[model samples]
Target: MRRSAPAPQLAKAGLEVLGEGVADELPSYEQAFKAVVNVEVAPRATVARSAPGASAEADRLWLEHARTAAVIDDEGCFLIRGAGRDWVRVRRTAHTALSAALVPGAGSMVIAMSPDGRRLCALTEEDDDYWIVVHRFEDRP
Candidate 1:
């Protein structure tokens, strides 16, 4: 199997990456559930273009403290749609994984921020697999 390259850093966009690895390496379901539970839930605030499938439980938790973002699109595209106008799409590196783990029946790219607004986690789909990328917001002087 061919390993994909590391994802691009999102620091310039105010998100500092803490750590990211394949979700399959996690040891237990309890840990994965804990990570996904921390993310804040809200009703749809912006218009979405496409609806990607949901994520799997095992792939949801990559880090305990790291914030996760999910992007669901039919074309397996990862996008950051903010304010219902600005659209920032990530270039896919790994296969998009839309397991039935987190957010069942969710569509479009999933972007979630940490409660304190200091961190972010992003999920993207590519080549029939889902990819998870995480970052924290850097403080400016």
Candidate 2:
């Protein structure tokens, strides 16, 4: 029997997780905002472009396959959308005052956040497997 080679780790996108309790430190408001924006929005265009008349089931399937994440800001929460490596779109909800911010190559299923709203923990994928990824407002450059 032959064994398969180990999957390669993706490049560090500067949003790598530091560890538990790292989120205790608070980030500046600007930094927090930027982190919230740095996520991908769900790719609705693919379904629209490929099948204008796609059924409800198709929509559900697309969402199931696409990678997703979320982050919170002073205004509200943001939904991040992606496929595997990076985010592509961000959607803002639960707030009327804040507007949506766009950032390329940032997406995952954000599962946790720091009490100070600086650090974020998300579930992302690498080579078809899901893994937890931590992101912080301070990590943004």
Q: Give a tens-digit lDDT track for model 2, residues 85-112.
A: 2222222222211101111134322333
* Model 2 weakest lDDT span, ten residues long: 95-104
lDDT of 1 by residue, 91-111 (tens): 332543323222323422344
CA error at residue 114 for candidate 1, angstroms: 1.0
- Cα deviation at 93, candidate 2, in Å, is 26
Q: Single out the weakest 10-residue window by summed lDDT for candidate 1.
A: 41-50
Report the CA-based lDDT of candidate 2 relative to the real structure.
Answer: 0.31
Each candidate's TM vs. the true structure? 0.30, 0.23
Q: How close is candidate 1 to the true structure, as a TM-score?
A: 0.30
Model 2 error, position 74 (Å): 22
- Clashes per candidate, residues 3 or more apart or on different chains: 25, 12
| Candidate 1 ranges beyond 4 A from true positions | 1-54, 62-107
Query: Which is the leading candidate under lDDT?
Result: 1
